[model samples]
Target: MPTTSSARLAALTVAAVCSAASTVVLSAPAHAQSVRVHDIQGTTRISPYAGRQVADVTGIVTGVRSYGSSKGFWMQDPSPDADPATSEGVFVFTSSAPKAAVGDAVTVSGTVTEYVPGGTSSGNQSLTEITRPKVTVVSSGNPVPAAVTVDAASVPGRYAPDGDSAANGSVNGLPLRPDRYALDFYESLEGMNVRVADVRVVGATDPYTELWVTVKPDENRNRRGGTVYGSYAAQNTGRLQIQSLGRAADFPEANVGDTLAGATAGPLDYNQYGGYTLVARELGALESGGLHRETTRAQLRGELAVATYNVENLDPSDDTFAAHAEAIVRHLSSPDIVSLEEIQDNSGATDDGTVAADETVGRLIDAIVAAGGPRYDWRGVDPADKTDGGEPGGNIRQVFLFNPGRVSFTDRPGGDATTATGVTEVRGKAALTVSPGRVDPADPAWANSRKPLAGEFVFRGRTVVVVANHFNSKGGDQGLTSQYQPPARGSETQRHLQAKAVNTFVRQILDVQKNADVVVLGDINDFEFSTTTRILEGDGELWSAVKSLPRSERYSYVYQGNSQALDQILVSPSIRRGDGVEYDSVHLNAEFHDQISDHDPQVLRFRP
Candidate 1:
């Protein structure tokens, strides 16, 4: 359940007071008529009796949430209605700690209100709840409603039906179609006790005591036991999030490919973060799948290994420097050059107008040497204070780390935070006007976002232009379970513009020297098949090397049970057609319970 704001809670309280006052003024006894729980939860996503007062709604308490600001209790009628479209259960909001307990038969009288989680603008479906409840204990120790089994067989293959075209593409008005759509199937069982048997974990447990599992064990199963999200049409309906109703510290820590042995029963809930979740009253025992981290083979002596890694907001104060250094040294096999994203300023997030990162980069270099790796030299242009869109005051930016023994950074001088770098001809060949410079930093597309960092490096006497990027994130996009069918992706507009800017820069370098050895890599923050990638690979100027791998092995990140790609490495035609190139999406993180970073690194080795 999503936390209701104090303002919204006050509004609800006022409305409840007004409704109670109306009941007192009406002389007719018909206003106090009783109704079933299914009547409150109508066939549609919203309640037909919303904002109206109902009396003597009876049910057995199946679950009680005694924690958090959204304190509530779920109750279900043992004798369900004949219609499958209507749910037999509903949640009663108590504002404070709920006094109801499991197995208690109670008669609740309250105003039926449709509360939208995350507010109405968020596109989330509304939860049918009874607010400002007046409860009457009818009996004690009554049997709780039998839990409904929700497995692959119970959920539909189709994700959702297209919304009614006349209603602005919204499915809120459409009747429930539980047999055809998975979203509707879950909606039909809202606030009801549900159970899943022997589910496989697809998302690792996080600090919030939440993890995701898939009921369909084989749905797009990869070799590492994660479900691959290939396309928008395939939303992977079997994936569901699980949270315990018990103590947060008691929740089992689980990784991808692990198993929840036996039945984990709970009430189906709709929350802000994850749509349909099981707040488990009976959590299953964790069984390890014996999954282990993978290490890539060392790069050949004659090959130049380039890698991209998003060290999730690395700062000098962080304790994971040793762990990250070990990952780069052992798991990634010490690449010749690495594009590190999210390196914070010296005073990490203090916001005192500090924009330098010499201390931060120096610490990482020292840690790498301590971990038995090469002594690396770095190059990067720090962004204006708070100009980059990240943790405010962190001043996150991209930096390149190259082993000085294997590669040399070409220093051209005169590159600053706001200065735009351009391509120029030097000795009848392509070269950067400013070696470590920003690409179109003043453009509106990069406003409040990390600008692309372009640098010149000489590997084995051959010049290579490397552009590191970290695009704007998907912050305002509607989620997969949005009430609006085929939810809108508003964040892609900015990313598409950002991609065009980089593509034009890449084209400029190729225009001067068509056979230039250019390596464009970093956390692109978009899928390999997205429009952003299409724009980056425009007119055969470049091609993403990640596509060379098998579709099941292309992902570098996992979210909500879907293994998908957000980090990529693209190369020019010269490098693509060069003497043999090897690409590996090293699986060192993103699938474990304890992760140093949320993103796995990608390494590409080729002869320049």
Candidate 2:
């Protein structure tokens, strides 16, 4: 392997002059062809292949020690297409070239000498390279400034990135290959350029931006300690072409001087650490540079609240709400009342009572009874027939359940009692007038997808409106492939319309709120960081429960290591009356623990 032109020039001069003395070319021209890189193939063994000069010797650098004081013994690259061996190579490193990035690509011209696994007792001809190997630094193609390199400690995948830290015979562990292929390579970045979320963001070298990309391992492989590679290190630099977004222009918020991409022609292959992982077989920098903004601040409280949870999808036999009914019952003990989401509808043979999705409500009712809380019942759901029925085991998601002991019900403006007809509107959102005639569940289904159930609940002689909401998921119009027929982010216009409707509904809720005491609960499907939450929380309305904490401590639950704030509680100013309401989160199953529901039942307290 030859290093950069300047590096090899010095080495070549030494080789030429030293050739005449005892140093032979071993050029059996035909045999030499075997070392022609492209001609070399098959497993690379130091023994049988001894004295056999092979080209393209690519293998893991199990042992990286500066041999004798002047040189070091390391393995050669087994070629991009070849397999890395457990321990190959007895090459000599001559401090030649300014230190080679270990997990780098090396082309060595060598004569192998067999050495025992750990070296023989008598020091037999363990494989050894007579000539010092030259090298070429590969690039990850990440545009980085010369001032900074990647932070190796946070590297997500395996690889001893430090040029000084030497390994004897094995490398570090690797990542569980992403559902999609992934990897981390090294690159000698030139300037200040870096790619973010597929988009290449440029830099002016003014306000340095350091970016640390992280990909955590699953339970099977516990490689902990934030695998977020640093600003720009050999371990952090690499040109990965895994369907990455290219160009500063291609990506929104992208800056100046960003490299489009210098990625490999195709997808990354599974690097052999233990299993599959995406990493750079070889990588480097693209110039420009990096950025890293560690924000510890939490999102401030907002007026509108939204949340999501798996709840294991409550069913007839499953009393999710009822089983956890204690939490809600205690919630009502506060100044404001709470809204229910994911209330299952009876989904069996309706007339005869064959347990179906609609029948799930029984679980809640039963649980409530066992707890002996005020007779709280649900309203505002779909008519048994209209709730996407037709084919089989019913899976209806209704929103009902109220506590009569806490607040009195009031029809919104004007409304006849609801029916079991299965029309889009089940009982229409039931209203519970809080103290002084304030609605606990404030706004009704104003627009789109079975809008939230709203009403009033009385607390401390003061009436407060409560609005329960469950919005669409940002997993991005998935069901669209089938049910929606046309994906919204795609061609279908209505899906987009539906999305707008959801947004509009949120707007309406904020608009009609009578006081700052409006508390919004229930699952809102959207996360705080997303556009949905932002749009819904509109203009200093609802106060957020989670955002009030610091960012690192903000997440309520984690999925695949990505901590997200899905289940949320937002209180209006009225609860605080200017001071903001008191709050706490019930994360029994969310500290990386699995529980009754995917979403935690959040709670808020106020003095009303």
Candidate 3:
């Protein structure tokens, strides 16, 4: 979700201080010194003096956040303590525009508090801050503290230590080794000035004015200059989030593999979004990585073309219809059949009783024709009211659109919005008893999720089976930037079952017809290398078409510094072993800020 306008305003103040060269003197009452910022922010995650009132805490104003709930300025001690475990800088929460300017030496009196941005229930770590501050500026025009270098060599080789039980996620209560663990590295430099040089962009720049970069490119590196997210064990410690504090002008429009010419200098901050962020004021120029939005693949003669795309909650009210249609017609070469996900009901997100998506699909098909493409016919069962979970009342479900001139859908009897379709053998060939039917609709794995839409098509007198799916998303899972070490992926369990359900249904069809041209594709919500995909492709029953591409080019989605495959097109043995089968992930959306959706559409071309 995007940050609120008020929060962005607060971040802008911090960015202003980062770019500020001089500070002006202001008349204010002076107070006697008592404690240092290092003492307020101890080695531990929580503040030692939390809930206690402290008098005359002395430090220089480094940066200020003038909006949001915890609006305040960061203060740093000019003379630091000998202990390397403690941070010299601390945030003063004023909850409004601060009176102190950058580089001002001042004394502050306030109550030390530990603030969790998303509240206590979120399981996120808290930031130590001084609230309700009484500030008195004693001097101005003082030089700010120099930033510490944080390169690959400065970062620790390991991320976190293992624990015996699930409760103990990582080794805690240890001394801060900024050079050892990535979490400790960020914690030690919390609220302090830091610099990362010659970094490569691993994550695309987001609309929230932030991007992630990889400082240790030599370790766990991809050919595109990104840090590959291999699995739970090899968490990439080199990746770091870069935030301009909502400074739109300072933020660059960058994609993965892009490089920064010079060093990015800023203060280290811990937030709810991505654990540790470098709120930089001065970022180097962005250099191109020779990456471009890919064009449509050449259409093969006498081959059936199919595609899978997540249109990102398309409804009657969305104005992205024309752009999406253009992408399908021009960039996708107008595939013979297209599998789509997230097609909302007629009323979109309104909590009305409207459940039909006729208006939505009609508008999209009309736009495709208007874009000089083939007129398409669509088929899908409207999900039961309020059963398929996705934006409330959106009634998001999978739908198939086929060119009537080239392919015809074999619609049979006994399919409904709720009933599951059974596999049956007809004249010694496996087929769906009810074409355009739901796959295991009542399965527990599909509860509150979109069920797979199965459709049998006859193109050029050859039978083709396509299953459109949108599995449960990866929500409620611990992020890589979480304080917990080896973050838990609790969401993958449901997806595993969902994959198994689809695989079993496909096996039923392949059982009777050994050479069936079955294609299972859509947003599985897991990586190509994930356990979910592994379960779907068990024992080569289904082969992921994405693996046909090179390692660096097998991505259809970019998330958190990893260009991984979330949207995939997996084919059966017949399609995998057949000649002249080509696959390409048309990378027009995922790598750009003006993307219509978070996922890129994937196409599979083959002669059945």
The TM-scores, one per candidate, come to 0.95, 0.44, 0.91
Ranking by lDDT: 1, 3, 2
Ranking by TM-score: 1, 3, 2
Pick the lDDT winner.
1
| Model 2: ten consecutive residues of lowest lDDT | 266-275
Error of model 3, residue 560, in angstroms = 2.1
Question: What lDDT does candidate 2 reach at residue 50?
Answer: 40
Backbone clashes in model 1, listed as residue pairs: none
- Candidate 2 all-Cα RMSD: 20.3
Report the C-alpha lDDT of model 3 over 346-369, residue by residue, as the tens digit: 999998978899999999999999
Residue ranges of candidate 2 with Cα displaced over 4 Å = 1-310, 319-336, 348-359, 371-375, 383-395, 398-400, 412-450, 476-516, 576-580, 592-594
CA lDDT of every candidate: 0.88, 0.35, 0.81
Error of 3 at 598 (Å): 0.7
Encode model 1's per-residue lDDT on 1-608: one tens digit a residue. 22222222232222223343322121222365589999888898877787678999999999998666567789999999898889998989887888888999999998787776666677777778888899887888998889999999999999998887897788877999999999999999999999999999999887677889999998888888889888888899999999878877788889999999999998998876778989899988999988899999898878999999999989889999999999999999889999999999998978889899999999999999999999999999989888989998899999999999999999989999999999999987899999899999999999899999999999888999999999999887888998889998898998999999999999999999999999999999889989999999999998999999998898989888888999999999999999979999998789987999999999999999
